[model samples]
Target: MSKLDWHADRGTHPDLALLDLAPESVDIDLAAVRLYRLGRVRAEMNKRDIGAVILSDPINIRYATGTRNMQVFSMRNAPARYLLLTADKSILFEFTGCLHLAEGYETVDEVRPSSTASFVAAGADIEAREKAWAADIGNLIAALVGKGARVGLERLNAGSAIALKAEGFEIVDAQEPVEMARSIKSDEEIKCVIASLRATEAAVADMRAAIRPGITENELWSVLHQSVIARNGDYCETRLLNSGPRSNPWFQESSSHVIGENCLILLDTDVVGCHGYYSDFSRTFHSGPDKPTDDQRTLYKTALEQLHHNMDILKPGLTFREYSDKAWNIPEIYEPNRYYLSAHGCGMTGEYPYLYHHRDFADAGYDGVVEPGMTLCVESYIGATGGREGVKLEQQLLITETGTELLSLFPFEEDLM
Candidate 1:
């Protein structure tokens, strides 16, 4: 349905108030997005001389072929369903009775019943199942590439890996190609990102509107969940909302603690939002009947400074190390509790190219150049090791040919500033 029609019909629907405030629906070409994304993965695979890739990671499967089946369930259930992509053809091994899920998608060339080998599916017959699964994979690889070719693989169980190896295929890490392919965005993909961010921010607004002096952290967080689902977005990947002292350490999931007057609440939108794209930005709110304290304002300003400074230096061709070298210097007191990544890549989920802080780079860093069309989330957290509260801030932006374009439009709490 058109955005206006949907909104008008749901204008008074109590559960959909956030949809009414969402930006008008964007026009996205689904076929273009599917084709472009599939082509990217294929190009990367060919560049690496990979004969075939077996993708079981739900995110990778979705990225490679625009088809999703039991994403969260399939994540933990190895080889429940997977895709086999060769340079010339695309084949999906779907779970039984779910073959229809991939029908008519231009990205998929064929769909067949998956060979179930995971213990949950096979039980005591797991060994026999593994051998059978390997045979199925080997037969396909032999037809498409040949016996003993360099095959790529994503997350798989040890038994499955051994089974593939027993088939004489040299398994290589396929994530390298898949992630590299996903790092850059097409115009069509960016349209979906924009729509996803709009939906997420609308939910954020509803969450913020619901925040008051006495609401429980879980109650406040549920507002966002309701709005995102009501807008047709998928589930959030995190429960990252927290209030008052619970916000100090960061990474604490939402709880039932009641918010108090003038205390700070922090949220990270690790949402698997519209079209399976992620909306990962953070904000800290002051639940106020009272003005934010001096300590709160200080934390907010510092985090804002860190976020803006990193975003300002982003551009195509900048190496990851160079970006780290020029990042805003965090005060020593906050170092112990700082956010691990200064910035990271974003697409279907928190993805490739994790940019580490200068402090952590000597041991934990890797080098890569930023490229145009890459979407990134710059992050900041300001709280001393023993501090009572903290402020978390993040901004999602597109790294353009010349500079950066901010994608998230949620306003920082002005009162805290």
Candidate 2:
């Protein structure tokens, strides 16, 4: 086997200086960065002729207003917090107890308590409560942009949409503008992602050290979860922890399955790390008292080659369709279980501009250009037609003006290869 040049030195990168500065000397102005982000969003809004935007997506709200409260809860339910961004002002509609939390931020022009009684009214019919909630939101929207004004709305519940239309407002799709603004990350955002990746990689190293036969998948997963939390990192978004046969088809969450001798263990750390940035990467391991079989080694090598090949092809200025045209093609035998895309963008979490394989691009692809300052996750899943296990590998990348930089430094399992 050839020696792989694992880029283990994180300090050599120019960005490392940003991470090493003393708190007093460091040029980390979060407030300024937040203002820059909001400015970018507003610029996009202006280009689209959007008067204001109603943002309800948690990530969008954070990007626009820099507020974090009950984020996970808001993902499934209607957001308890919302922001109305206008040309000259920003108004945050927060839940009653949460209004105080937004007071410290200079980004918000005003903070108002969002009505919660309607959401919790037990005697009221569900439809009535929804109507009441929508009415309140519509009234707020009207106050911000006035009646008959054109507004961009993101993540609006059906009831809210109807109410807003009834209130004589023109609603346009606002998600794309926010996504486009977020797609190109700022230097501070890059730093946050780097911090998260560092923490997540450290946790993975801890898990690798503890890997062996007889340990349950959950136990190993807990080690990673604990390591991230101990470092003051936010919660992981997925439990993509699985071993052996369970790892074949992919997308399996961690379970109580015991690690058997010479079995492959795959883990994807879909963790949200420092400063609310997400670090997503996957590493495949082999539990051992014995070396992996030849087939396992082959699988690992194939996946690693695919990973590097895709990374090499990625750079600034490539269109999504062009990338799809050049992406690695899975063999006919393994095509059935192939993942949806070879790569996807990442920021707050797994997000847009998913670069599809040539085979899947015709039906699943979207058109966009890869620009500098975009961060992407290049993925590889290699499993045979009847194989019991597969190799899963992913690397986070940041597109630079000249080329691309690898953000994730976690080494592949050399023993498995």
Each model's lDDT comes to 0.89, 0.81
TM per candidate comes to 0.94, 0.90
lDDT of 1 by residue, 56-168 (tens): 99999999888888888888786789999999899999988998777667788899998878888889988888888888889889988999999999887878888889999
lDDT of 2 by residue, 264-339 (tens): 9999899987667888999999888888899899989999888889999998999999999988878887788887
For model 1, what is the alpha-carbon lDDT of residue 268?
95
Worst 10 residues of 2 by lDDT: 2-11
Give the number of colliding residue pairs in candidate 1.
0
Clashing pairs in 1: none
